[model samples]
Target: MSTAIASPRAFKADAAFLRGLGRAFAGALIFALPMLMTMEMWQLGFYMDPLRLALLLALTVPTLVGLSRFGGLRPTARLRDDVADALVVLLVAALAAAVTLYIFGILTPGMSAREIIGKIVLQTVPGSFGAMLARSQLGGEPEGEREKDPPTYWGELFLMGAGALFLSFNMAPTEEMVLIAYKMSAWQSAALALVSLGLMHAFVYTLNFRGGSARPDHIPAWSLFARFTLVGYAIVLGVSLFSLWVFGRTDGDSLKEILSASIVLGFPGAIGAASARLLL
Candidate 1:
């Protein structure tokens, strides 16, 4: 009788795990589909500097840890649980990337092991992020439960960075980002800087977006500007620079050129930072 009782319980647990895995794949596909289809991404996967790719993958771990703490696909109560969730999601992302790339004929028996691994690793970055973001994007858990575990101030900032990175990744690989930056005059760059800052502040604090709880009326203007807006823009700029560097757009560029590119990319990055709460 006890064995019979345990069997049903075990079966139910197995079913739940499978369901979560399915959600993970769906989320990975939803977030990574565009890059999967992009030809530049496929080429970059094989040729991007291995050291840079490794560093980027290293950075992903902490990002995943932060996302797990606040908005993981599964509720995690302990540090180990969070780590486990991240690893599981990473595995799911790797599998999904391999299957999708193979189906699209991007990966084949003709490729060497190093080339195959690089392709999968490059794709896994976005796929794993999508897996981590599955809970917020694809829906899981109750609102009350989520609210009970509200992200800390640092976690909020981290989420802004993640969202900025995700939104900018698609554009970072395109030649147009560099072309646009090269064409802009210094004054135009300055104007863009102002616009980016203003839009980020407005979108986060003033626009009253659905997911954001920031209230200008309740918070002092000085505090709002200093605390959220400035900090958010800082995150955007950081993400912009990092994205450019990862995509090789910063190669051979002087300091002035790099700064110009960052400022140009900062427009989209700032918007992403501001709308992180809604997107993530």
Candidate 2:
């Protein structure tokens, strides 16, 4: 009787885990589907340097840990829980990418081992992000709990960087990013930069959005701009450049060309940075 009861309890726990994993997989697919469909992404995966890919993947560990702290696919109370969740999400992402790519004919047995690993590694970037975001989208933390543990200044900045990276990754591999840059004159690019800054400020400080309200009367406008808006834009720019480099879009590009592309990408990236809190 004891053995039979124990078996049912174990099965129940296993079922719950499977359910959570399924939710995480779905969340990852929602965010990564576009990148998976991009032809440039597929091509770059096979041709990009292995060392660079490894370095980028290594960096994802900390990024995942930070996201897990803020909003993981499941609630975690301990450091070990956070680390375990991150590793599990990464495994799910890799499995999701491999299976989906295989189904789409993007991964085949004929492909060399290096090529296979490269493709999955590149795809895992967005996949892992989606996994981390799963909790936010699929429901894990209560609103009261979230309010009880708000993010720190640096934590907020990390959220901005993650958001910027996601939005920029969606656009960075496209030829249109470069083509739009080519069409813009220097003055237009400058105007764009100003516009990006203005929008980020307005969204996060002045305007009321789903997650943001009008600034408190005590907080000065200049202070808000300096603290959040300026810093967020800087994060956007950094994330934009990093995305371009990761996508192999900056190879052999002139300084002018690179700047233009970064500016164009930075526009959406800034919005992402400003609105990250709302999403997560």
Candidate 3:
């Protein structure tokens, strides 16, 4: 028991590998998304051009291999954890990336705060939920079992509040969903995903590592998941809202748009669910 608990992350578990994995997942989404949307499963001349995606995936391949070599970090997500966490991460990551771009736009003076956030959430929401459903369907587990283990309700309420507020306040003017399928540059979309993934994983792993690698340890407070959930969600939401209110409000954007647009960027987390999976 001591050995299991005390085991240190070995080989490829280092920061470089971690960063690379984050980047790969992000880049793959960017590369595959446009083509997938345009061409579907079949590759076509205009949409299915695979050069950049192939390159991006290739860039991370070595890192993925190295990371997996440590202990098979390949996505055993289904058996190990429900797909909700990933979706949550995906949504949060997208928002994070959007926020990054938002800051960038402040300096460049072209993109609207609302437009960027809206576009990001629009494309990201579907991908986030779709990824969840995709993994769940592929996972082949009974919905009943998954449903049976519903997360502690307190955590859910707080997180939902936090997530909703985060989304509504920070990402202003509500970006148009149309941007997801159109308008974004290849590099832009990939950058969006990559940065967001990095932010999400950093938040998660920091908590996990701080918590003694035990799911229970990761809880906000024993029998107080809601309290902690509210706090964590609150911090993130506050930062996002503040970021938008300051930088996002400069233009002719409507106040309603800014407020409505700020939502928790990722999937409303499965707090306890993530905790359980991290432990298992």
lDDT string for model 1 (182-225, tens) is: 99988999999999999988887778898786674776888878
Alpha-carbon TM-score of each model against the true structure = 0.92, 0.92, 0.25
Per-residue lDDT, model 1, residue 203, is 86
Off by over 4 Å in 2: 1-14, 146-148
Off by over 4 Å in 3: 1-133, 158-257, 260-280
* Model 3 TM-score, all chains together: 0.25
lDDT of 3 by residue, 1-280 (tens): 4444444554334453455335534543543354224312211111222353334223333322222221122244343232334433355445544454345342134645544433444334323322332322233344344432333545334333333332332232233322231445556544543444344334444465532223455555433433443344444445444433432332355543333322223222223222322321
Which model, 1 or 3, shows the larger lDDT? 1
| lDDT by residue (tens digit), candidate 2, 1-280 | 5565569777896687688788789878988999898888888888987877887899888888888898886667887888888888888898889889999999987899888999999888789889888877786557556552767779888988987887887898888898899999999999999999999888887678877746879988898889888988988998888878877788899999998899999999988888887776
RMSD in order of candidates: 2.6, 2.9, 16.8
Q: Report every candidate's CA lDDT.
A: 0.84, 0.84, 0.35
| Of candidates 3 and 2, the better by lDDT | 2
